[model samples]
Target: MSRRTRRHITPLITAAGAAGAVLLSATAATAHVRVIGDVIPGKPATLQFRVPSELAEATTVRITVEVPKDLMVTSVPKLDGWNQETLPGAGGKGTRLVWTAEQGHEIQPAQSETFRANVGPIPDRYSLTFNTEQTYSNGTAVAWNQPRTGAEEPEFPAPVLVVDPEAGPPPGSAGGAQQPGTSASAPAPSVDAATPQPAAAEDSDSDSSLPLVALIGAGAAVAAALAAAVLRRRGARDGSHL
Candidate 1:
């Protein structure tokens, strides 16, 4: 191509490539298992994990989450299609939670499920991380244990929860007793994901509006991603002519 034509086409190609990258990144991110909802530092909170089955042909059959030893998980509410098991930690608190799908209750490809547990009084911290292992029916296991440390996110980042100190009552406040913060002097016991105790009635009413808001936001993202792809294609065609 001529120099003038090449100059015009180069930026178009670059812009197109940038748009395509954003589209792909947004598409891939929806598959990550993520923690949802705010967690107060000093109160019992209902924490939820949204697990999405990423395989096209296989179903997700088992999920195990590593609970930090410093945090205490109280109970897990029963999910309709899964059975819950807990490994006890110090003082009868749960350290690891395992959820296995019942026969024919596996999370099929392109589907997702949510698991909830009562955890707290949360330790005083800025954030918490939960490493998760996902087992597929086809015998493949994917671990979402990689920590995100930089600007770019890890391919399979472990789910993380940010502690909201301002929202909840102060630590050791009445009706909201605080747990001791993680200490360097006293080593914490080795523990995996927090598991639940007895099955308790889940409060569906709390945070009820979040799902609708998330759905709307996700729809907008998908639309933007599609537009990005279209722009990339148009840029490619225009560049080819140049």
Candidate 2:
């Protein structure tokens, strides 16, 4: 190939690789919000929902998460220079939560924000998901409310907290057992040992021992005959002396 062709081809390959990387990053970012910090079952936990601003010219202004029925959200903590509120649900639970930045506090393009909430007595469950809504300064609102499907993630899938079923129980708690909403491990199977049978009961056992038993019986008979002959010879010698 000519030098010109090599140079042009190299640049194209590099550009393609860079574009592929950017596309992959964007695809991953659109999947869902993130849950930050330790998640312990049946105990207090601090959850942070991370949001990213996509459009290079737009600023993110609002974020809201719809809490599930099983979760008990105690409080929505405000970030510095930010506003927050907890909207009541049907059963008086914290159904919808929102966080906003005032005036010049909007999250800019390529920037991110984490909205945190302080809650207590986490449910004994394996996984918890909360649908979310993200709004920009330009009034573009998006929904993150579905599970993943192949390489096409939901435009805004919900945030999730997956609990470790085998995690030890909280301090001062009773048992360190598997949490609810989690699968139970199958138990190990039991086994029985083979029992030994009497020699007379098993044909193979008698055959294996017959040769040894015959040898012992023949040796005992030979020893008895030798002893009798020795005694008789000694008695005849004594009679001759008398």
Candidate 3:
């Protein structure tokens, strides 16, 4: 191929490769209602689920959120212009709270709604599905129960909130004992007393050799002084005899 043609095609190939990479990296991020704020175990926690109203052009007529049975949600606050229904699960153990958006509660285009509920003491981790039904003036019902999967786009996507298990106490505090740092009444670590050391004995065999070493040193010093005196006397006698 001619140099001019190769140069022209190189830029086009590079641009195409860069565009492909960007498109592959841009995976669809599905929109779903997420549970926000702290959920303490055995305590009531206020939860809010955000609902987008852009699913349909018509004003939303009714919005219903199905509370999962596993969460053990006991009660919901009453809101003006809104109706609530609690459906009992199997065996009538607990009721699932459902909120219905009444007439004039339609969320207009480019708007959103925040649903609030106080939930607590859930038995286990669970997920709640918010199924919203929007009815327009034309008698059409739009169900938002369709969930997004992979790259597929749903006409009306409902939001889902998952409740996770709450973290328990730290290690060694299991038996309801008062944990450390709570009160001075808790028991402290005990320390043992040190034992007394024995004194060295005077008649011990290890010390018996000390007196012999001193006697040997004294005898050697006396013998050295006597030898020196004898040598001096012999020198004086030899000089007088000569």
Candidate 4:
């Protein structure tokens, strides 16, 4: 291959490689479900569903999420331009609530839409599936409708709170078993206030001495330089007189 041809193709190859790397990085960065906030078991917590409007664009007009059956969701706040449908489960219990936010309700491109659900007093750990349907202005629907299988990679992963059994006695409450001569409150450390805290004093003293030492060294250097200059001038004067 000619040097001229190689030089021309080098930059093109480099540019292509860089573009490929950037594309791969962007795909990897966006390839997971992002959950915001801690998912505490048995406690009321707010969860925000963040959808990337960049990839879905105008195509995603509506979003739907399947609430976990185990979690006791007391209320879902009304969102503008969105409709809620609670699907009844067996025995008059509704296990799933589907929230549909359509075209006009859809979040703008490069923007995030948040839906809040109040859930609490759950007995066990459960996974809530967010099954989303994005309908474009072109009558095309893209379903971001995949259930989180616990094993799935997350972008902003919701924390799973582990509820452990309460340990021992409550605060300030005494148990039946008590050792003799032992007080409920632990003894405070005995500090010798009378003892001369020489370490701190020495440190302060050293810090103060450092400046004085530096001043002395500087004065000595200045004195020595002046003495040398005076000697040089005296020798020059004596040589001129001679």
Candidate 5:
């Protein structure tokens, strides 16, 4: 490459690198806490909270999440280096599950933890949102309780689960599938498309209207012509008699 081109390319490369780094940092900041598995509605499912340590100077000491009243949450997975507990919420209905670092163990900078729990009778709803707080050893706590979707998401947006409900039973359970001799039932086809019963009624109505219209028009024309003929015949009889 020419010397001039090299000088211009050097600054462009530096600018691109800087932009990439900013984008990466933004992604990491927004994805600090998220759900790891599918959130099924109307059933108890295993869920995981993916937590990442963001502070470079301190370790993450504790994490708390507000479980919705609709979801029944009780058990937490036994992590080797973490302790879990639940506290009373503002209302008597829900729970605030807290997971703290065990003795001599903390989530260091650039580290992450996956805390699992079986939480639900998940309501049949569109989404599940959890408000969370991540506390650092330096007493800094970051709150993640913001709207899930918009033109611009929050710095630490609340983790949301878009519920997906399948009609069949949960997987891996016995007797959930069709019998060996039977075929799976297809959805009943729409009556209009499959049977075409309504078309007959519509056609009947249309045929009835066409005959009525033609009869009305023919009757009107015959009445008008008959009136003219009567007038002419009356005049001719009167002149012949005179």
Candidate 6:
């Protein structure tokens, strides 16, 4: 192709490549087992975990989520098609929750499942990370237990729950009830673990918006590249006629 044609096409190609890279990164980040909501520093809260099957050829058959030793878990919801087991912690706290799927209940590729536990009088901490292990139908196991200590995120980072002190008062502290919520009719057996807690809160409003900002910037780059290509073609046609 001519030099002029190359100029128009090159920018378009670069823009598309950048956009694809951004989108792929975002998708990969969301594929891991993740905790869905925040918790108050010292109150009762239900934690929800979303686990997705990332293997292209295998179905997810089992998952195990760890609980911090300091956290008190009151109950686990009974899920259909899965059997739940809780590992006991010191003082009757739960350290881990395991769920095994029954026949025909495995999470298929590209599908996800959610698990929940009612917990708290949450320890005074900035966040909690649940190191999880996922087992696939093909006998492969993936451990999502890495911790985030710097600017770069680790491969297979563990699920994290943001602990916001401003979220509310601790149970019996103020507006909230004086005691922790009662346990479910059938609470899971508790276990103890020595999971380290973060020193301070790292999640913020700005951090949450970073992904959206990157996406918008990528879309703008693509749009600009497309517009430039059209303008170049129009100019070429005008010159030919002249």
The Cα local distance difference test for each model comes to 0.71, 0.67, 0.52, 0.51, 0.70, 0.71
Model 3, 206-240: lDDT tens digits are 58998999999999999999999999999999999
Compute each candidate's TM-score over C-alphas.
0.55, 0.54, 0.42, 0.42, 0.56, 0.55
* Model 6 lDDT on a 0 to 1 scale: 0.71
Candidates ranked, most accurate by TM-score first: 5, 1, 6, 2, 3, 4
* TM-score of model 6 vs. true structure: 0.55
lDDT of 4: 0.51
- The global Cα lDDT (0 to 1) of model 2 is 0.67
Query: Each candidate's root-mean-square deviation in Å?
Result: 36.3, 13.0, 17.8, 20.6, 17.2, 32.3
Q: Model 5, 97-126: lDDT tens per residue?
A: 888898778987777888888887888865
How do the candidates rank by lDDT, highest first?
1, 6, 5, 2, 3, 4
The 10 consecutive residues of candidate 4 with the worst lDDT sum are 10-19
* Model 1: pairs clashing at backbone N, Cα or C within 3 Å: 65-193, 66-192, 66-193, 67-192, 67-193, 67-194, 75-197
Model with the higher lDDT, candidate 1 or 5: 1
Task: State which candidate, 4 or 6, has the greater lDDT.
Answer: 6
Sequence-dependent TM-score of model 5 = 0.56
Q: Which stretches of candidate 3 lie over 4 Å from their true place?
A: 1-37, 89-96, 126-158, 165-242
* Cα lDDT for residue 112, candidate 2: 82
For candidate 4, write residues 1-242 as lDDT tens digits.
23642233321112323322122236533643344546555567776666555442232354445555566667778888878665654465545555566547665555666667666764543334444443333333344544323334333333232333243333322322345666768875567575668798899888989988999999999999999999999999999998
Write the residue-wise lDDT of candidate 1 on 121-166 in tens digits.
8877766778887776655566888876555677778898878544
Instruction: Choose the strongest candidate by TM-score.
Output: 5
* Model 6 per-residue lDDT tens digits across residues 1-242: 23642233321112323322121235644678899765666788888889887766667787888898888778999999998988864376658788889999998777789988889887775567788878766555667888765445667788877686455533432233433556435565554334433432345656878999999999999999999999999999999998
Model 3, poorest ten-residue lDDT window? 20-29
TM-score of candidate 3 relative to the true fold? 0.42
Deviation (Å) of 173 in candidate 4: 42
The per-candidate count of clashes, in order, stands at: 7, 1, 0, 3, 0, 11
Cα misplacement distance, residue 57 of candidate 5 (Å): 0.5
